[model samples]
Target chain A: MASKIRVKNLYKIFGPHPQQALKMLRSGLSKENLFKKTGHTVGVHNVSFAVQQGEIFVIMGLSGSGKSTLVRCINRLIEPTAGEIYVDEKKITRLPSQELRQLRQKKLAMVFQRFALFPHRTILQNVAYGLEIQGVKKGISENRAQAVLKTVGLKEWSAAYPDQLSGGMQQRVGLARALAVDPDILLMDEPFGALDPLIRKEMQEELMELQEKVHKTIIFITHDLDEALKLGDRIAIMKDGLIDQTGTPEEILIHPATEYVANFVTDVDRSKILRAKNIMIRPTAHVSINDGPRVALRKMKKEALSSIFVLGENRTLCGIVTVERAVEAVKNKETGLQQIVQTDIPTTTPETLIQDLIPVAAAAKVPIAVVNEKKKLLGIIVRVTVLAGLIGGGENNNNVGSSAESGNNVKESARSMDHISDPLPTSITGMG
Target chain B: MYLRSNYRDFFRACSGLIEGAVNNIEALLSFIPITVFILVLVILAWRLSGRGMAVFTLVSLFLLVSMNIWDETIRTLALVLTATFMALLSGVPLGILASRSDLTENILRPILDFMQTMPIFVYLLPAVMFFSIGVVPAVLATVVFSMPPAIRLTNLGIRQVPAEMIEAAASFGSTPLQMLFKIQLPLALPSIMAGINQCIMLSLSMVVIAAMIGAGGLGGIVYRAITRLQIGSGFEGGLGVVIIAIILDRITQSVGKESPEKKAA
Candidate 1:
């Protein structure tokens, strides 16, 4: 996949001699080795990710996780050590300071947590500041700024200074200022972190609406999993200067790849994560007309079946009756069938979070069902598959530093499952 | 012969101060109407500062007028205004420069402290030496004596703006000059206004000592009444000067208080 923004193994270490620190990092020294040799504090380490165009890619981490440092390195706000950063296929990491500044002015805009509006200027002038910096004439910049202010619902307040506005309004002005330049990307550093809860939710909705209209790629950094779930197409969960997991909201909640990710998503309700597609089991053989106990018994013995799916004359699922039910029917001896048994099965679609099935599986003491939107059976995942997805094969204790190699192992597992008769279900955990 | 000459000189000095005070009586009286207007204005100004401050301001104004030098008060105010204008003209740029560079802050700190802590009377000697006992020397001395606080405060205000705000401006495409002018200065304005208020007060306090260098107004009048043992005249003149101080203090403080609101409004 081609990336609009590509970051390759970026690292940032803050110290009195940052240039010297970068020099040492590039020599292939371990972070611990470098720390021992010099007193520099590591802000970001060996972080790499690529953002697809028009994706709302969120970077999630607690404070001091270096997610902020990683985003800053994209624009060289904090210079990265030994990285290849390509913005629009041009290697931006090595651009000279003047060129890098020009690129930033032309391509990037930032919204801050504090809003950072100028207290001295009217909102119109504050919004116009970025255009003025790009050498646009004052009248032209002001005109454009007025248009942007209206876009953010602040045109009526254009003549008022920042001090006259509420916290949410000031942040709207900040958004307007960032948008005034019409940059290709927005770097939002927890832009709503300071607002009250109600205002924060309002701002988030406003941001979603703005993103829909602008379609500019956004790299929004935050620590809140709920916020990440609500806004991100793909979320990268960072811990101790490295990515622990990157996936869709359902994936993160259902099968957290690391203890860090599980800890992060611990408070979330897993039932909410699953859809209808993930809980259905694939059937090996199809039988119609709701077969009698004598015929069902022969097939179960010949096929080595524990359970058989019953289909109606219309070729739709009627119910699943176990081989034990058929044996009990034979023992009744009155017409050789006492009852045609039916039981409710737990099921999910592919879009459903596997975590959502855990409670259903626990309540019914049966494997959860998987189904499509129409409730058509697809495949079922037992407890074994769900657990396999969490730890990647259940027995491999190797840590995530081996991610590049783990991807190959995942593909190999998928292939090996194809060869088995009465094969175990292939478990998948989506991590971007 | 010596006693007679001393007595004669004292009478002449006394008459000169009385004449000066009488000459400025209208200017001093004009301030009563302005002072009343300012007190009302200051009440509005103090609304932003709070009710407690408004009460404090009203009490201070009463104390100032009751001191009894009303005519001489206006002359002292005019001198204070003149010196303060001069100080602002010189101080704001110096403050901006000091804030922009660490080297400049280091260079100017000791100089500002020396100017601030030195006894203000020491300025009178130099004023007399150079401008020779008149209004010009008095104005110059007061301007020099009171200008440091304004510069220091302006510098402090500009330097104290949060670094995150500056970085936000930069990333949003603000040039360095725009960041300083549009972002830093506005955030720093409250502190700068505080510095200017201090400058005005310091200038007013210098006026009494300025009288010794032949800057005749209320101070010279008081000097004269004492020498001639005219207790009643001296008391009246002294009270007039106090009225002027109260009025100037109130007006400047009002102006300072109103600016932030005006900016917000």
Candidate 2:
């Protein structure tokens, strides 16, 4: 995966004599020593991370933990003391002010927590603000803004003042404004923090739907761990300007690396994070549907296979059979298990993350078997996928195979279907 | 017979009001030299505003002396000081009362509006009917004409003190009086001083009109100069009035400027 943004050892300090104070502080001086030399307030300490293209990266922390400041540093809205920030292979932090302005105009746009809509402008004008600043032609910018506004479901309110709109509507205008410029990456700082709970949920859903379509790299700053988990492809939990841990939500939740991370994930429900793949049995030679009915019955009798995946010629899911069906088919003079198989069985794709599959599977009280587009039976999974995923066995249990596949085919099929069936990942959904 | 009866009752009431105003004015003018000496002290107060303002004060005093009507200037000053003292005495207390009670504020509002909008010449007519033409009548007209701004501003200033500061003071266990003195008054001082500036300027302006009713001063000299076609004398007397205006303007402005800072310190 290409790195869309990479931040290395960033620091930002604020004070009356910030530059001189940082100089003293960096020269191996203590706070008291620095005070005697020059005094300043520390805002960001050494922080580092990389966001891959098309990733929903989140920085989670309380208000003063510098998550907002860190995002701003990436955009250089607030300058860092010592750091390197690269966006799309360009060193954004060191860009001259004019070039940086162009960089923001072309590639990056930011959304503020306060919405920061210009009070005097109507919603149409507010949404068009960023494009206007970039000196886009009036008609073109307005048209773009209108299109973006429609995307956020605010087309009818284009003529309304920000003060005339509700808090959520105003925030939609803010989102539309950020979207108007067709930015490659968006930096959002607590964009929904001010809304009521219902509105916030609606907005989060809207953002998720938007991300599906646009797939823009997003750096979302939020204090709500659940929000971070729900939105992030990878979450960087920050404390006092330092990244405590950076990982997928599942990785962080199941095996928190420290006491702080443990406490953060302690309240989360475990079953929700695990899926069928985590608990299902591995494929064996007798698992194949191609085996003759008498051989299959003998295999079932030996290994106690009540039901097993039945794969066709191209390693695609043909269907499944119970021991009773296989035995009945053999006694009735059927040649194969496929002739006796039940065809209407439901299955999930390998991309289906455990956290998302658990609710439907548990409610239905049936294992959602993993399958492919050609109807290939990849593997059978029960309620234990979610459990195993939650308890640190998710990554290990991801290795599921078809009834007909060799080891090579299993690995290849898993790679192709990775994260495709999962509409929402366990790392993100478990926190939600 | 009806007209005669009404006229007799009106005259009787007018005479009583005139007697009261005369007693107050006579007592106020008796302390004239001390008042002039205090005006000089007020000049010193003017100096503290800034060096530039002190320069403005000196120039205005110079213009008054050069007009060659210094004694008349002093008499005019006497009436002005007396009127201003009376206005301040009545207006400040009333403003304080109005500030405390919403009812008083509502009651005084229309009265203040009337006092401000009524013509200066119209005010003198009532004074003349009551006191029948003299310095006492002139002083009464001047005070009534100028008192509104002072009272209005004092009320506004006190009322406009921020609720936060007052709450903070109250939390510290300060009494109502302590809050009024240390917090409200200090914060409101700038606007109150602005009111005083307006009052002084209005009083100086009223002196010229007072000359028409036989209250002699630099205004009488200017009136005589005009009637006798003594253009130079009228010009000089006018210059003297302008000078007095500038000096009073400067001193009141400075007093208004310094009080809040002193309290803050």
Candidate 3:
């Protein structure tokens, strides 16, 4: 969990007299107050954040909120008026031109929102450009570029010019170009913002899968809240050149520090975004596999349940023992519940989206088993809990555990259009 | 007086190289027979432009040869080519400087404006003053007259490259020099080619004007006809200049009009 990239006290002022404006900013003047006084636009003011190694840190804001400027400052594409940006060990803002270039080539890479491809070069050549600049030999660079092209699913399009490709294909080439250098930190300035919604979603998913392998620390900039929630390991909401809040998606959804963020989450569909972990009930009527069916039937009867889960050592789900099967097994003198247990019950991971579990839930006789990677039962996601979560019944968080561990208490769900009109958070207005 | 002497000495030092190049080109072009030279130009024109332009080059050069102005026309061609080469050699570096810094652009723009706007005849005085009356002065004068367009367009071309592309190059850690060569120059090549086309045309026009300082060429023939008022010879020399102009214009204009894709990597 070491910080791969750390930015400290970053400020970007646009116009003449930035130092003067920065002084005003330090004195607690708002962006509008400074603008109204000095007529100089503030880009990013007094912003700082650290990204853990291999984390996708998304910076989201409306246009003109300086999210793009903040990203550019990390790589020095847009110089900050005052700041310290550290990519790994080097202080990028203090580095001389040669050392800065070394940092850019060796430690960091960028995927531009506009693709920013060399229109003249073929896609392969464009992808290889970073390596070529780093003085890698032509044959080796081309091979590396070709391999990265395959990773981004643009292998066959390598010979074509960027202009010849469609926008999505062009963006794939852009991603390949960034990946070709194998830099540890990727500064993505709304890389998928220009793509159509379908392609953007595919790229989001592809990036998620790709991150599992490449594990590069990425600082992604976007204006889209859904994209922020979907891709960000943690998200920072920017406004008027200042960070309003930074937290996990669930935190931003449930405890929006400002009304703007609440308004953003208030419209997000809960069923699609909420996972099994958010709704699963804790399993109580269960027994170890060593127990006999006689013991199982007694536990089931004591819990007032017809069926109970049978778990092996380490709480790995063995199967289920129905009261009828348990009774029959006991009458027949069966020693263990193994003969009576049925192992065909449906199962899902805690992270499985509720929408993904609908069909599985519809056909199941019992609640779906929410298991971890080793098949240890984490909890049970009963049908009614999923139904209640989708319907925005925040107080109806029923099932195994009554611990309301998830909600930040913002909006439970956007089941009806009325949630859209829910009062905007007053915190953002109070700040302005 | 010392400054003038030093200036003269400096011009004297460089004149041999220019003198040698001009003589070499003139000798090479004149050595080839009129028919062979025209045929070569026709083939080259065909390759660069198209068949129609090739036909025009062929017919025009043939007419100049039949007018008995072949050697003079070749001499003018040599001077124009040498001057154009010199202009590009010197202009591209200045263009790079102008593109890299505002200070250079500010310094070069006014000088470039002065070079381009002054009448062609005025430069010959300074050229003759420096090198004395010869092909060197004429070639050097033509170089001066032809250089501005190449330099200006090269500056403008480099400046016109998309900022995003430049950021991409810089973000990849391209050194200033590397970015200039790999990104700026290659992308700016089409505009550079167009600049060269203008340079060539300007040099051709100046080659005729440069003849006043004792340069040997079709320009000299045109000067002699203008002075002596020999009607038929005057018309013949004028025809020679027109033929050479058409041939060069067709070739360079076609090249300038070529797709940037063809010029780019």
DockQ of each model vs. true complex: 0.38, 0.02, 0.43
Give lDDT: candidate 2, residue B182.
Answer: 56
Q: After superposition, how far is residue B124 of candidate 2 from its true place, in Å?
A: 33
Least well predicted 10-residue stretch by lDDT in candidate 3 chain B: B256-265
Per-residue accuracy of model 2 over A1-432 as CA lDDT, tens digit each:
669999998888887877776677677666555555555666777788999998999998887888877887887767898889999878888787667767777788777777776544578977776676666799999999999999999999898777778999988888888888888998888999998889998999999999999999999999888888888889998876678899987777755777787677666553444344533444442346677678766665665545555666766766666667787887889886767866666677766666576555534323456776666666656433442344343343342222222222233234323532353345446445
- Quote each prediction's TM-score: 0.70, 0.52, 0.82
Kindly indicate the candidate among 1 and 3 with the higher DockQ: 3
Model 2: runs farther than 4 Å from truth? A14-42, A131-150, A155-159, A212-215, A249-259, A266-281, A290-346, A353-368, A384-432, B1-265
How close is chain B to the truth by TM-score, in each candidate? 0.70, 0.80, 0.92
Model 1's C-alpha root-mean-square deviation from the true structure amounts to 10.0
Give the DockQ ranking, best first.
3, 1, 2
Of 1 and 2, the candidate ranking higher by DockQ: 1
Return the clash pairs for model 3, or none.
Answer: A254-A408, A254-A410, A259-A425, A281-A400, A282-A400
Alpha carbon lDDT at B216, candidate 2? 83
Predicted candidate 1 versus true structure: per-residue lDDT over B145-225, tens digit per residue = 889989999999999988877877768655567777778887888778888888987886776677777666677777788
Q: How close is candidate 2 to the true structure, as a TM-score?
A: 0.52
On the 0 to 100 scale, the lDDT of residue A24 in model 1 is 80
Q: What is the lDDT of residue A154 in candidate 2?
A: 90
